[model samples]
Target: MKLAAPIALALSLAASGPRDAETRAWWATTATLSNDAMEGRDTGSPGYDRAARVVAARFAAAGLTPLGAAGGWFQTVPMAERAVTAADLRVGASPLAFLHDYTVNPVGLPARLDAPLAYRGYCGAAALGDVRGRLVICHATRKPGLPGDADRAAALRAGGAAGMIAIADPGFTVEPPRWPFAYARSVRLATQPAPAGGLPQLTLNADALGALIAGSGQDAARLIADGSAGRPLPAFDPPARLTARFAFAERSLASPNILALLPGTDPALADQAIVLTAHLDGYGRGEPVNGDGLYNGTLDDAAYVALLIRLAERRAGRGFRRPVIFAAVTGEEKGLLGSAWLVAHPPVPLGRIAADINLDQLRPIFPLTLLTVHALDDTTLGDDARAVAAAMGVQVQNDPEPERGLLRRSDHWNFLKAGVPAVNFVFGYRPGTQSERIYRQWYRTGYHKPQDDLAQRIDWKAAADFNRFFFALVARVADQDRRPAWKPGSTLAPK
Candidate 1:
């Protein structure tokens, strides 16, 4: 399964040109960390430990000082893991394949579940019928007037349903639901309390809708079409029963965050450190898709982390006016656990941390013309980002899809919540353009699936341009005389 050599060589050859050195170097690091041998760098797994070691070695070679726990290169984070060892689900006599036809949420599950099926369109408060002790099936919709996941779940739980099975809405074309989940697992910090008495949840593949309602006197295709078109849906009890048996596995483990520092040369500004963060975790080994089970999160965050290492190399032991801390965190896919831990128990005092420049959700597949800047107006950091992007012929905009909640989805939110100015980015595309098509394709196929490996297409020039912009932005934030401050009248700003 060691495929790093061939992949790295191919990437280097593809990046050969005027900017070959930087492109090849960054892609090489990415290939090394995301290769099959790294096992997708799952948090608390041995693969992640190996990746952390490589990052620490790279930091050492770049002449950065280790700033982890006990003067070492690792910050140990304790965590609890829960997984579905085995699952069998059936709608009457038709059995549903786990991970392919459906996947369960891995918080906790009872050993056995046998309940009648109840279909309530959108599962809104008014639409839910007498679902007491029934297995409710809801249409997962994101329409403005529809009940979202939280509202639907609360309504179902209050209706005394034994469990919920939400049919994935096909109409969410912006980010279409992809079938065949990698796996079902959940992780949380050991100190956090485990969920109590929460209703078990499952997501049914929209494509497999027919199997669930075959004998229920309803047409699956019509129901899906009506749901997608926002038409009213009929509520009924499918003449069937849902029977499931689950085997649960639980364990305790610890993962480490790789921390390094490039100390400032000026005594006055040295104490105020600018923290740069990117998560170092991926989906790891999961249910096989296209016969490939490994979910190498190449573009999701590994590329940005490699960008961090490249930046350090470009520094060549030189220091900015203010010190910079490079943090490759863990457990982001599970939750924002690593960054939360760092914020709560920081290596340096929270007051001394001037700002956070997060690197995640940057996809350089298309030309780097537009960028979606998260937290674009909350702090002065946005001002600095706009200046840097404009100088490179790039236009920045606030998140175009606010409903996705990109602001709170990444590690930067932890720092921002703690009153530290922070920002993250996404590759943007204009409507009705090739860039939009490509961006949408990636979200549907590569966002969290096994297809996100090095085998995917990459725009070398675009990647290099983003790297330069990132380097310039970091230097601008670190060398500036004034600290990044929250803008006036901002909702997130401290009172």
Candidate 2:
């Protein structure tokens, strides 16, 4: 039986039924937790620990079962953290100063470096600077073995480069750098870095580098390959002549793996539950090392995660027709660690899971017009998504920037790795279509700066509407009578 939801369900949720005090509480919780001192929840910090406790408490209050690997809410996943310090990044003796001569990502934003930049190209592309026997820098944007990256790196190493330096791009920054300013504060958004790897690396202070990049374009690139000239190395040792004084360290760190469940009312459908997720960790504590601090992590996933917790509260009273596992995962920033752990050692049998809905973000900007059911092109899940969105009165679009790599970026990727069918919700990929120039403004100004704080500009009405639609869609999927199936030879598990 097909049930048609109110086409205006997006607008009139207030009049639809019981007042959603739970959703409101969830929002309050997110805002409060994110707003607390200790730099807005740096993972592994005291603030993060407190944040975890609060979430666990919230989950418990909402009546979620303890499905953590250890049977409690906290599943401590130990991470081996390393920061690359020393070696001011040289290429055969030509001195490359941090951000001035060759601005590398190093650790990207967390575990920043003050020395020994690894300069990894991660498969050499132009958007990223060139490297040959020189230290290379890159973000997590590129694919792992994109034809020539490895070849070039190998060639560079063979050419006598000392090491590689790479920093994963802090994915989707809302704007550029700024000190803590009131103008930037108040707005709250969220997302997680696209899933990425294990590499010896470092991070750069974007503020310092942004200035350098703005001044000279090509000259900035040359200075980073400092030692490549074979002996006449630039003298930067003296802090005054020290065009770059980089510092970093190599150490270990851990990440988070969030889990939530909505128990099914139906016996069979309940047995086959759904797994949803988003990463909760950022680039890990400061540069010249592997990463930085104050990752405030809104879209890096605070907001996405907030949504799951909120949904759990809603589902708690109503109860799931099928068990819903809203896993607020950690370590997705570090090789899908949390999701991998769950798939490997799930609270329930992995096969019992019917499907997964991994949410990264619809877009930082709310009131988004289109919905991108990313990577569901060949699956039945894709059809379900389209139908669900159409029913909600919104247009559904395919990922326009598939080349930017949305498919392998979110936590849902792990479910896919484990042979579970999954679909990710993507919004605002194309700069032009979203809101006539909104995307462009974000890329230039708010991409990753301290400026990406809460503000009046966000489409709260749109975001709220989308969330309502998402709530209904998931409900429809969970309650379907027929088992969702993939077409023959689809990249998903064999039917």
Candidate 3:
């Protein structure tokens, strides 16, 4: 007989481990890996490389055999880098110069494009004038070195433009500084094709636009004020010319899943493995934000990775006899790339893995007031998480931003997709309120902003508390030797 997906996952995870005392050890292991010097652990960066090395070393010290195929622990993740040069533009066979017509300021990403552009102004409020299926251009009213502008290009791509360029200066060419917490300028193509579209998008720099009307050699700000749609500029003296070159890199990084074997005294149960996972990478910042260059992300996640490390040390040589996998995956910030890759290629068989204990952004130092389970009330998993929270005197709630798709956002997504029993632990809001202020505030302030550096206001004790609470939760599941599963008829399959 075949078992249902959720049940199968529950059965496997239920038999993995039964360790409760090593929670602080787990915290220490993760904290050492999240040092501020790691620079928000940007994937492929020197700091990120250092962080990966540190994790491998710690896994070795913890008596966990390297699951990586190579003799050494490190699995080099291949990557490439390219610098941007000048950009060009052409409209109806007429050339548009870089400073004269188009602009580009996007995070590093690979592309095979030089598509047409459409002038989709303020999300298509202005007439595109046969500018579809091409590189689209739009205008931004915000200053250059501000936050929130990544979506400008994405909208264009979604609107059927092959690519997008956000022009901060409506007409001028002053080189503006990068914005902190800015939106992703790149666009994901929507399925709906453009209906007889034109060129791609071009967004002008709003702050430095006034200086553009006087032709070359003008302040960037002057262009924004003068280039009003109501007003017109002098015809091109010698006709404008446009040319731009964008380069980005990506590669196969053979990332490993950290594993430790506790070796159960009972021979039958020793075969199963429990998984405790957390993603190591965050969207790194290349531009300066609040006078900081790197996105340190001390509180956002480093704190939690620290929690896992501490817990691992706490449980060394004790805990249950079953094996445990302490997996710190990479590229989670980039759409859970590492975890997805691992699930497709697990060192252990997919069926032999038991429940997953996930710590996303643990912060329980000050007062243990609230806790959130991504799959709360969805199955026995919620009940298990709730029981743990209740015993610890912490309030529990279901994910507040289910609509935002947080349930399927991180490394845990891979485990869930593989039909492995998994759960993501996080704190989303105040105990009594449903507002997602915590997540939204983090997003606006440091989700990917350079301001994520470790500062005085960070509550370090929170990470410690998360370690203890997680220790208890893991024990509740592992010690019992029972699996929790998603409810039947649940539509919660990984997308």
Candidate 4:
């Protein structure tokens, strides 16, 4: 005898295993969001609008109430963008290729630039001497006690340099510099102030450093070696002059942030809400990598956004003790603009936001043995994350590589700045382990590249495990009596 259709389907799902079903569901959402038809979901593009509509429909189906602008599902975010349409550069008659040899920062660049070249080692305040009105070249280093990008920029600007050209460090293996930048562009919220008197910056391919230093009686190879090794280097005038012309195209556009809410069941705890956020934007078509131009940002962020949808669906219209906001934000690739706008113009009172459990930078390519928790000591939300991970037999550790500046890279940083306790996670691996190998390989090839598509390999079990952890953690934070708070003496705590 044949079973009824619903009963047979349920039996099939049970036999196929719950984890299998969940993985398929999660991947289905991720695939849809990152597919070619979505056109990479560039912020303010039609593709991003389509993706937002899909997310809004999913939220509605999951019984979420629209909590966006004007009682609709989307909060429109106005944006201004600038893109370099054409550029020409010649250093002592050596015409370097745009994107192939170098890419300008494209912010506050003059229409024309003609200046002499000065090799300022590290561009530190002490190393830079009489660089006024010259284009200063510096070695980009991440070593301890060395001047970083910000410090270098400040010193060059204060020293009255016309521009700054930094050689991309070749020795930083953690995140090796990838040549052939797609393009140079900058985007900001329309209401935000434009950068004032910013120095024009350029990043020269390390391999192209010789072109800039040729005929100066200095060995480019030796300088690179010493710079990469953090050794002392001589500063002198390179026998070259830079002449460049740039043309830019500017436009204004708007994208929507998909917002939904699940109200609390308990009146006492309902005033405090837990905010869950993930960005919905990805790098659109740009310079082709291996003949593929589309950057399907699957694990980079689309997958985490999918995880948010899965959590909403799993709730099945049930309310927790405290309300929860599901915010699929936009413009994270454009410097966290959407989350910033949301925090500034909140649907609910900013004070009601007790904590943020952000979903980004999570790659479950290997077994979920260890997790790196960002801001692990800054707030009580870290305690909730720790308890959730520990219950699943996963070890939690503080971010081991703070030099990457990941703490300020994602949407959670905006919430954290607003004094809402926030936490984010990364799949961790021990040194020299297979997990480390896979993790690093992904960064080199898949991170922000066209290769980060659905075709990439995924550990289904690990994905399911993270999804479970996220669900449990949200429940723990939403149902607990005490709202999440900043730990005393935490530097990130709001003054």
Candidate 3 achieves a global lDDT of 0.52
Error of 2 at 488 (Å): 2.5
What lDDT does each candidate get?
0.88, 0.53, 0.52, 0.88
Distance (Å) between predicted and true CA of 438, model 3? 6.1
Superposition error at 55 for model 4 (Å): 0.4
TM-score of each model, in listed order: 0.97, 0.69, 0.66, 0.94
Residue 178's lDDT within candidate 3 is: 33
Question: Candidate 3 — worst ten consecutive residues by lDDT sum?
Answer: 186-195
lDDT of 3 by residue, 140-258 (tens): 53433222245554445445555555555323222232333232332211221322432334444354232222344544343335433323222121212233444433233333334
lDDT at position 44, candidate 2: 54
Alpha-carbon deviation at 414 in model 2, angstroms: 0.9
Instruction: For residues 119-214, write the lDDT of model 4, one tens digit per residue.
Output: 988889998999999999999989999999999999998999999999998878777787678778999999978778599899999889889988
Q: Candidate 1 lDDT, tens digit per residue, 338-360?
A: 99988988889999999999999
RMSD of each: 1.6, 10.1, 12.0, 4.8
Model 3, position 342, has a per-residue lDDT of: 63
Candidate 4: C-alpha RMSD to true structure equals: 4.8
